[model samples]
Target: MPSILLISDIHGNFPALQAICTQHPPEQFAHICNTGDCTVYAPYPNQTLDWLRTYQAISIRGNTDDKIIRLLKGQTFKKPGKKEKRIMYTSTAESLTSENSAYLLHLKKKQVLKLGSYSLGLFHGSPADHEEFLFDNTPEKRFQEIASTCKYDIIVTGHSHTPYHKIISGIHFINPGSVGRMFDGNPAASYAVLTIDEQARQKIQVQHFRCHYNTEEVVNELSRMKLPEIYGIMFKQGKKLN
Candidate 1:
């Protein structure tokens, strides 16, 4: 059996990602897959990107990444209307260096990977759209339809920042949640591990895990950077502090 790590929505919190990586080193896994939103919302955009590059993790472009790319190209995909979103976008965009921006711009939007005997579809959101969200509470019928339409035996996604594993239409769907900014009332980082049992009939096992990091460090950095105070509040409370 071989194990693969599934991570997503890093949101520029390097400490969180580092903590998760420390617990499950890259050498222990056959492959590492990131579902996107690799940068933004916290400090350390450059460091987070550097970490991902060092690990050679398979990554897909997330909506946040797309926004950064659009900014770099002097374009706008969607205007940030809300105050918090505007601050988040602006702060993250300004923090990224030209080199980091280029790396993000080149990230693929989707990936179909062959992991051992399993064919996996990786995306930031649903297969049909990158901005769409597929959460744990999504309707099974709808998930089944999406599963049937895709060519993969398993679909791995992120963006809702919630972790789940479900079988729909005989296809497995997993979301490893957010590695940086978690919104489920827990400040701990979230991720998943997929184990492929070559000798077993079932063939796959999904395990979700959370790692604790120094949230105060991120919060203090956010404050030091003069990003909106709400960002720090959200990091501390694990929800919108408004």
Candidate 2:
């Protein structure tokens, strides 16, 4: 059996990422897989990317990552009311080191990993769309539609910042939820552990873990950066503040 540590939506909170990694080191798992959205909405984008690079995490680009890439290419979000977002994305892009920027630029939108005797499909969202949200409450018909089209035995996705494990038509879908931000009403950082055993009748086991990190530290860092206070509040509250 191989133990895989699954994480996603880090969003630049180095302290939270560090706490999770400290609790569950990459070396302890068969693989440390990140579902992306690694940057944005917090401080320490560079540190977050550096940590991912150091661990050589299996990662794919998410929607916010795409925004950073586009910002690097001189394409700014021109929407009238998104000044804060524009600033946030631009600042994150500007903070990226050359190596990290190149890493983001070359990332594939999706990846397929062959683990043990099973194949896992990894995506920021669903296999067909990078920005789609497949949450726990997503209609069964939609999931069935995806399962019918998906070729992999297990489908791993992020971008919803919500965690869930579902089996539909003999296919396993797992989302480890958010590492930096939690939108499920609980503020604790989230990750998932997956074990696959070919000999067992059950074959697979998925568990979600929540590790509490220092949210005050993240809030202080955000304040030091002079970014929007809404993000700090979100960090404190574990959900998007409207």
Candidate 3:
């Protein structure tokens, strides 16, 4: 049997990331894959990127990650509607260390991994669009279309911040959910353990897990960092603070 740990949307909340790492050490799995959104809206993007680089996790560039990179390259999100998010991206981009920024700069937008007989496709969102979200309620026809086009047995994604596993058109679609942010009214860190049994007819199994962390601690830290109050409210309520 071989296992891979799937994680995503670690929006710079080091504490929540720490909780997941503590519970499911990366070494325990054959490989660790991060779908994306490794930075933004949290206080420790540098620490988060450092951890991923240290573990050599297979990572893809998420939408927010792209935003940070662009911001570093003198791009600005000056649109009136993006004021809060612009602050987040600018601050996060400025906080990155040179080493970590370089690390983030080299990440691919998508990756395909071959684990023995199984092939896995990793993306921050849907295969076609890095920011497109595929949820449980996404039309079956859409998934069928993706299955027809995507060339992997298992497709892993992030960005929705919601954990789910669905098999459509004989393809396994898995989202490990958000390690740093949860939008489902639960303030715990979320991740998934995917196991492949070589000998079993049903070869793939995914276990979604949530580890409890101190949400208020992150909330307080956000205050110290002078980020928007909505982020703290989102952490406290475990949902979008719109």
Between prediction 1 and prediction 3, which has the larger lDDT?
Answer: 3
Q: Which stretches of candidate 3 lie over 4 Å from their true place?
A: 78-80
Compared with the true structure, what per-residue lDDT tens digits does model 1 show for residues 41-136?
Answer: 888999999888888899988988888888788887556677767777777787787877888888998999987767999999989888888899
- Model 2 agreement with the true structure over 65-165: per-residue lDDT tens digits: 88888877878655424776677787899888999998888888888899887899999989879989999999988889999998999999999988999
> What's the lDDT of the predicted structure labeled candidate 3?
0.89
- Candidate 3 per-residue lDDT, tens place, 68-144, comes to 87877787654425577678888888888999888888889999999888799999989888889988788889899
lDDT of each: 0.88, 0.89, 0.89
What is the alpha-carbon lDDT for the whole of candidate 2? 0.89
Model 2 alpha-carbon drift over 4 Å, by segment = 79-81
